[model samples]
Target: MKTGDQTPLICYQEMTRASWRQFRPTTDGHVAAVSVDRRSQLALMDRRPSPSEIYYRPPAGVYWVDVSVHHAMLHLELPTAEGVFAFRAAIDVAWRISDPVRAVKDGVKLCEPIYRPFLERKLRDMSQEFEVGSFADAERHINTYFADRAVDLPSGVAMVRCIVKLAPEDSARNHIQQRTFDRHKAERRNAEHKAHLHGAELQHDWNTTAHGLAMQSLAHGQETAAVEQRHREELEQQRIAHYTSALQTGGIGVLALQLASSPADVSEVVQIMLHQKQLDLESARDVLNTLMEQRLITRRDVQDVMAPISKVIADRLNPTASLAHREPLPELAAPPVGPVGQVEESEGLDEDESDHD
Candidate 1:
């Protein structure tokens, strides 16, 4: 068999069993050939190819040849009035024609994912719309409706538009009832959401009140404890001051009494007493009491007698006396007689008088 040029020869025709068989090689030496049985050949020759197929062929300048197989339109009859309504709804929902060609292609793509499932669910939910009767009339109705729909369908898709023709025999009441049910369901969902929010708000308010009360109680207890503690500290300080004043007064009185009974060398006595008694006023008082009891002196005797002696001794021992005794003493001498001339004069006068006589 002789092979054609590397450039591929593309052809378009309606899909069918015999149409596909035509692409197979025959007994002749042609590498690629297309043949159809008499009936299919006539059908292919009679029909024109679609615009997409015409454009898809290569060798940009080459003209195109048309071919076709069975090109009958397929129709689907919904089983119920609800089905019909849902179909109409779906058609309405898919109304956008953005990029008409692409939208139509996309709408076909969207059929299984969006429209088919939506239609099935709607039919299940509103079963009353399905009327058990001749599907032929329903099919006819759907075909007419879809044809009209396809007129507005985005271009490029090879779909026949359809419509939903309600049977004159079916009741309109079912559709009305389903619409009411849908509305009620929506309202119930909203009510449930609002109730949930109300419950949450109430719980939040309760928690806030509880926390606030707990904090207030804690603060009140702490404040009360602080005030009581302050009062206790003030009372303790007052007690300490009273005891300290009494101790100092008693110490001064005891110091005076001990000094009165002290010995004449009382400074040394007091110093010795301080050392032996650990410099305590109470110990000095004890020493004075012991001396008074041993000597049998009355309190007056201790005051008047011992006190004077102590004073005299203190004055004698004063540091100023030694400084006063520092002046020098005069040397001793005898009394003198009268001069000898005075004695001779008296003797001579007596002799002269005798001679004159």
Candidate 2:
């Protein structure tokens, strides 16, 4: 009540403040702790409590109370390689009126200047340093920046668990992923190139080996043919030598025949000479023995004629020469007679055939 009816000096208003409508009336002029919105000073009584916000108001007044109690969440954004990185800081503000009366005279001491968090201002200084790194590197940098250090807030507040994250757009994540894919692709290409070269080298070696085998096979065939030709030549030479030996033996037989027919006991001598030497001598010896048993010539007469023939042959031959190397007998100039003797042994022969045999 005022004194009587003198001029009334009133200060408190009855109308409600848009921001302070829900704030419970406090007794007297005692200072209280309450939250005021940045836009309209909406007290914590009316505004819904944010997930990370806390407030305490024992009494409603224009000044901060002596008790220090405040909590706030600070959000900041900075550009990064993975896009905007949102950093968070949780602050426990220690606020109070060191001088209650002076705080009232000074208005709200825990307003924007004191208890409010200037997170963007702090991050603005660090934006240039926080570059967008690689995919995981960006996340690591954000985590490390907050995890490794403490943060200070307004009103002498210390941050509790500061959390930091990178909120990238789809494009940013795609860019990082694309770079990773390109690196893997390059490595794979290099591996493929090396394998291709190795395959080429292996193919070249195979071709070279195959060519060598072919040449070796051809050379072997040619050598075999050459060996066979050499063997044939050797066989021909042997055959010629054998034929020449046979001819020499026949010549000796003919010479003996000519000697035997020399107008006396010549034919009988030739017959004996032909009978004496043959390849194996079995058949020829049989015939000679048969002729002798038939008394074609007396043994004494045969020995007389053969002894002179042997002496003549021995004089014609070289004494030092081996028999195998001896010259054949010379050709005889006798007329071609139908038969050398009238013995029945050669009676079936034709004229020319008898002479040759």
* Residue 167 displacement (Å), model 1: 8.4
Q: Write candidate 1's Cα lDDT for 275-307 as tens digits.
A: 332334334345555554464434444455445
Global lDDT scores for all candidate models: 0.39, 0.44
Report model 1's TM-score to 2 decimal places: 0.25
Q: Which candidate comes out best when scored by lDDT?
A: 2
**TM-score for all models, in order of appearance:** 0.25, 0.35
Look at candidate 1 and tell me the lDDT of residue 108: 30
Candidate 2 Cα outliers beyond 4 Å, as residue runs = 1-76, 80-133, 151-155, 177-199, 223-357
Shift of residue 208 alpha carbon in model 2, Å: 3.2
Candidate 1's clash total is: 12
